[model samples]
Target: MPKPPRTRAAALTATALLLSALLAGCGDDGSGDEDLTAQELSWKDCPAPSQAQGGGGSPSPLPDDGTWQCATMKAPRDWDDPKGDTIGIELIRVKSSGDESRRIGSLIFNFGGPGGSGVTTLPAFGDGYEKLRTRYDLVSFDPRGVGRSEPVLCANDQRLDAYFQQDSTPDDGAERTELVDSTKEFNAACEKNSEEMLPHVSTTDAARDMDLMRQVLGDDKLHYFGISYGTELGGVYAHLFPGNVGRAVFDAVVDPTQNAEQGALGQARGFQRALDNFAADCTSKVEDCPIGDTAQDVKDRIAKLLKDLDSKPIEGIFPRQLTQSAATNGIAQALYSKEFWPYLTQGLEEAYDGTGRTLMLLSDSMNGRSENGEYSNIAAANISINCADDKPRYTPEYVERKLPEFRSASNVFGDFLAWSMLSCTDWAVAGAADHPDVGAAGSAPILVVGNTGDPATPYEGARRMVQALGKGVGVELTYRGQGHGAYDSKNKCVQDAVNGYLLDGKVPTAGTVCS
Candidate 1:
């Protein structure tokens, strides 16, 4: 799965609404796009989110009764042929609250996933960014091939439920064949449903779109905030339009140097490290840890539970059962943030007693499945964007060979993530590159924040991003803390540095450390 944004409240609320119910961009610049750049967006009252964007009511008023606005900007569907066809890029924003004279330009955000709906997410967590909104219009969008932005579609929800329920960690040849076949079927569905889009959803295309967005928004420079996969998107934007970058910050940074295989391996290690942290935190609490006696014991018990679920699934939300795959996904989702640790503990405790609602809900959140059985297009977009960006495609045999290495990196997530490498097998469009190029030599200083306990992107990625971005272009900040990103962690130190840089043009010192 792609690294989801750290929207803990939204994820949890989705589950509650579902048990009662259910739950659940690019770039830059310039030449041959004069009409697009000059087009004025028809911003209006926001409508309720579409199913592709994850079904939800329209955004509520801001804390000060400021309404969120929505707009769709037209962009060439194919950057190679700028005038050939057009697609809508869904956008949402709230104007700056402070005096207009004091306001900076728009502060656009990309909350990662490479597949996430920034249109929906911005409002879900708009309050967290209230301070930044004081001086800049907080803007985000559903990049092309995502949400209402000419979304990519795959299998129906019913098929997806079965698809996700399949035994991901095969024990034999037959099971391996089944896994491969299922992946091919999923990819085929994507091609059948979105053939035109498959070829144009590359990160490079999105980067160009962002540049167009910059022009349409009337910003001379792109002031930005990116998290997780968004960081990678931001890096690509900077690389493509170095001179257009203004104040930018990349949190939970993705390593721009690693190829697909290396990236997966890094995540395996990152997630395992987070699991260790979760276990340690659980055991060291003053209250008795209900799940285990020691840190290792906690992990051991989880392994046993998964082992048992492989053969005999547990009761999940009525009619569905929690299989090993679902349990593993749930655990990984919880490991995304320290605030979610308690939910993991509770889910584990409940699973031990044969109930799997909590874990299943977590897995549902991960997969973009809602209580009503409808799904957001996140999974489809994630696969499409990843397959389009990552050049390498893995076969079962290659995955089998790499299993031991993956297992060594993470016994719990090893086989699972290893198998995930086959997501692009038989994909329709050939990928763009081995990995992303984020070398922005002339770009403004971009703050790179890495959390020590981030499971998805990993802490090491921050330094790797800094190095890959070229010296003096990427300034590194270490948050010796937990979660997928730092600023949202409500860490005063991390936020202070980011706020200083973005709001006042005061860049934090290179190699700054915040606890």
Candidate 2:
């Protein structure tokens, strides 16, 4: 669901967006060697982007802009439309002030979330990317069904709001009925209203769009940086266009072959890993960690609190009533970054002693809840793109059978997180059966990053992606930290390695673990 720049639900609507981690791993007391496994994951195909500028849906070129310009590139809403009756893709190009003289054409970035919007992303990251900006023009554009572009709309604001607020997790049998029914409703609505766009918003389609963006930019190659789901997009691009591969950095990559089910399972494991880390941090600073000496004790207390909240809503900030599921997510979200550790420890200590406000604030921000009660649009996009792209892993029977496993998977979030999956079940289209295993793409050299304890896009994902990209180099930056997408943090070593690749063609050697 990644938009080139603007977030769909992944980061856009807020709920679906993967929150950015602000710090790195410094301490680990929990049990679960949460760091990425260093085993060399043997990869398969790594294709280069095809630069054969001849047949098959010729891209409509847009005029080059020193600053900002919008041009149309030809694509297919159906892909069977090669006769010039093409889908008009809108492009926005912004130049860096540092690289006018030695500027290469462009370096595109996908922030993930199948629904992520690049158009909406430029304003935030455009400036910080000064290093790469000077080397190449920073290009951002909305993917087909995202911001500024032909957005794929399902239920409008009010309906979506209702759907999101519904309790995703249901403890009792009756509650499960409500969840199933609600999910069915959302799915039906999407099917009825979003018939036109669902089939088109896929990783494959998005990759092709990037190729067109490259062609229109007049560059012979495709240089890209993507996070989370964005990594999925970049990986697919490399598969589809191995010949035109340029400098690439796939930060926090997603293995294209794994479907949402397996991906969700990995995420389930990640949260457990993070929770174990949190417990360790809490226990070490007795004063900071109020939950006894044992990690299991801490988990029990939090679970108990969530259970209490489920029966009776708390009277706190906006929305007035915080759900137990949301509360648990706040904890998981907090674990994504090391900067939040102090506050997270504080929230835990207080919660163990009967206070949950601090943690509530963390959850509120993660879901994009404004001081006023408005949820971000990212939730919508996240549901749409993911649901559409991957087929459902659980059926009524499968979900019922797996309930205990998922419950053990997230504790306070097990139920709600389980329910958050209904969107794909009801989405208008059933996209790829699974992310295409493109190991045979024969793509160019790529750099894959994995943080040891990244709860969001787990380190395993990076390891798997590296194995998936047979020819790419894997740079394992040992964070001894807790967070996702480590490049954004102030880690000089990792930053230097990343910049060297983007600005200069310096790819780190295999097993190049950074501190």
Candidate 3:
């Protein structure tokens, strides 16, 4: 559910445009391997993003007429063997606008997805961070096995279209077998296409790369901004290089304590809570709720629509039909942000009339499919990194057994998330651990922001992260709001707290609340 838990927190941002117009070798041993860190980056004007990075024109110039710079930094293919082959980590940045004398080194960002290409993302949302840019260069990069960083390719566009279309929530034995076979085939394709990369794309390896990136950037401490899954990455980085951390923020925080199953379960509940909130909001409006007479009625109609779509799909974008799985995906995507709620209302209204175009567009956004039908490696990288980081692998039977529990969590999302546990079935690489180790015992204070209505990472994760980051390290800030993250909501209160912490050295009082 929520596109595999650590799925792109920016999906709602992408979906809105569709509605309108659409490792290892590289760990901190304290020795700081001089060779890799010593190499200089050759920054130049950013070129158009590659297909793997979600193809688009080059980043537009900043308000001050400064262009976004792009570069590739070499990192170990495997952190366990730092001297072995190297892979390029694609990076993008815009230098500070404030006085050079007041500049505070580079402020790096990783905006979730684990698969998201920060090179493209940073510039797309660059204007929002202009204030921070006044004191620091806003920089972001594609981790190894993602985007232009020697990306982990699996099926091609046509194959992916078919792959995503297949039913993920199976009912009978025959359907279950088909789902398993399809999942295995997808995993096999990834291994065949990226055997070498599959083993090294774990979170730990990426953490090491960040440490190397900090050294190469000439920053004595790594100043960072992490959102959603990026928060997990930030935690791992802090754990690895406690002494090297500068000011860091973790928003829409992921619980470092949960294993894959627990994480999925948490998302099922979170999405369900968000759905309930959506229903209540719609019904409370002055005008009649277009979708239902009451909040419960709205949810019931959705459940009925899904059940009907399972057997008889509806006409979607020209050649495709909207199947139950795709509709569910689209709904999940819409639930990510409250701004997209109106779109969800309209999509549901249209779906009730036997048309499915809008919902399909949202599904396409979730899968990283563009208007041109080309796909970024988002889904591929998500599965690859998740399978490598998580140790447990589930069989169809296990999912079947867990269905009731999942269903009880959320009538709309339960079975879907329960079935997702099989994504790592027959994965080529052995997983690294049961759960990530994020105990940064001696690290500098890291601001952890959580939104109460966040469907993906959930708000409770903020508290878990605070505890896991160890006492005095994670300063918890709560935003009683909707959507996946707090900072991007542009709520002045949340932004003020975060900006105060990052722009200055003023960490908000621990347990600060922003509404």
Candidate 4:
């Protein structure tokens, strides 16, 4: 999840938010193109403000931002059978800030949630990327199963609201059974609602749509920036179309090689490390701390609080009660950036006071819940895409067996993460394609960034990506900061390195550490 610009600055002003050597034959040459029928995009003003900005049922317009124009691009539902059915991919493009004659090219962006909306995000934080926008027309799209595209809506608002609050940590056999049952119900709902679309909404499908965008835009090669889960999509694209890969940067990188279980294990440990860092920082200023004076004290108190909420929820300023799942999500959301740490402090303080408004809102933002109780299709889309890309869903018995390992990885958030991965156990996959090793061998040197303290996509994932991309194809840049994303934070070294790469095509030397 991305921190909106306002809160991002606040967190990073308090904190700070990498890469290595040039490999031979890694530079981009004027690329070749296979002649294909290219579609054209007709730009128009976005929909009304209420429909666009408000979490309404209809499609969102371009957030009333004057500079952005919205368009819908047509893509084959199943690439292998292109003529069978087609779907629309929502796109928002902000033209270059400089003169059109001087414009370099379009830079595509994806902001991480397998379900995250580039339509909403670009408007929320576009200005911060003045360097890129000034030179290239910044383009972002809602992939096949997200946002204003042909979305995947599982449950309605009321049902989803209740589901979001379900207890994440099951304490007994009955609780575990309930958890498994709930997972089945949710997956069944998604299948019933979006059976035709689920099979084609994986990262590979999205990458094909991205290539369509490139063809329409008349770009000879692809220039892209992807964060967190988006990096997974970009990596897939790079491997599929190495010759089309241009200046691509995968920040807060995800390792494409890991299966669902391995990915979850890494994330469990990563989040635990982040919580420890947050606890250590929080204890230093005990007066503002909500739990205790030391990291272990904070950990124990939080674990107890979650356990307490599983049985008895706290009614906060909102009409809904805060449950263990929502509270865990709330805490995890704030862990994305240090600037949000104070907000986490404030939220936990309120939760301790028996009012959970702040924490609830935090969780709501992470899930894209609106003030009026409307929901984005993100939750459904996130599960669908993850399940589709990483096949082999775990059975109840498998999950129970792995429970101990997960708890050992993260006593606080591990069980929740582990059980949640089982949502696709019963969901059908139509000819699901196996993910291959993605090195993009013939592509230009791709920038792979790692944040030493990032929780969601751990730092080691970046190293793994570098290795996957082979010796020369990957450039490693390290940020000694705390956050899920590195480029948009307050670190001048990181900002300079990224800006320099995007603007001048200057690749940082290997092992470049930005402190």
RMSD to the true structure for each prediction, in A, is 2.9, 12.1, 3.6, 7.9
The CA lDDT of each predicted structure is 0.87, 0.59, 0.87, 0.74
Q: Is candidate 2 or candidate 4 better by TM-score?
A: 4
Residue 37, model 3: lDDT of 81
Candidate 3 local lDDT, 267-348, one digit each (tens): 9999999999999999999999999999999999999999999999999987889999999988988888898898889899
lDDT tens digits, residues 1-515, model 4? Answer: 11111122222221221000000001111222323346677887655322122242322222223277788777777788776556777788877877777677999998877777776566556777777876788888778877777788788788888788776567888887887788788888888988878888988899998998998988898899888887778888988998999898988888667777777777888878988998899898737566776888888888888888988999953678998888888788778887678777777777888988777777776666666677667678788887787667677788788989989999887887788667677777742544435777888989898999988888998988888877788899999989787988758998888888888899998789998
- Model 1, range 142-208, lDDT digits (tens) per residue? 9889988889999999999988888999999999989888988999999999898999998899889
Angstrom error at residue 489, model 1: 0.3
Give the alpha carbon lDDT tens digit for every residue of 30-116 in model 2.
Answer: 232222222122222211111110001222222233344334444556544433234545455555556367776788877766555
Relative to the true structure, candidate 2 reaches a TM of: 0.80
The lDDT of model 3 is 0.87
| lDDT (C-alpha) at residue 491 in model 1 | 95
Please tell me which predicted candidate would have the highest TM-score against the true structure: 3
Q: By TM-score, is 1 or 4 better?
A: 1
TM-score for each predicted model, relative to the true structure = 0.96, 0.80, 0.97, 0.89
Give the per-residue Cα lDDT of candidate 3 at 228. 90
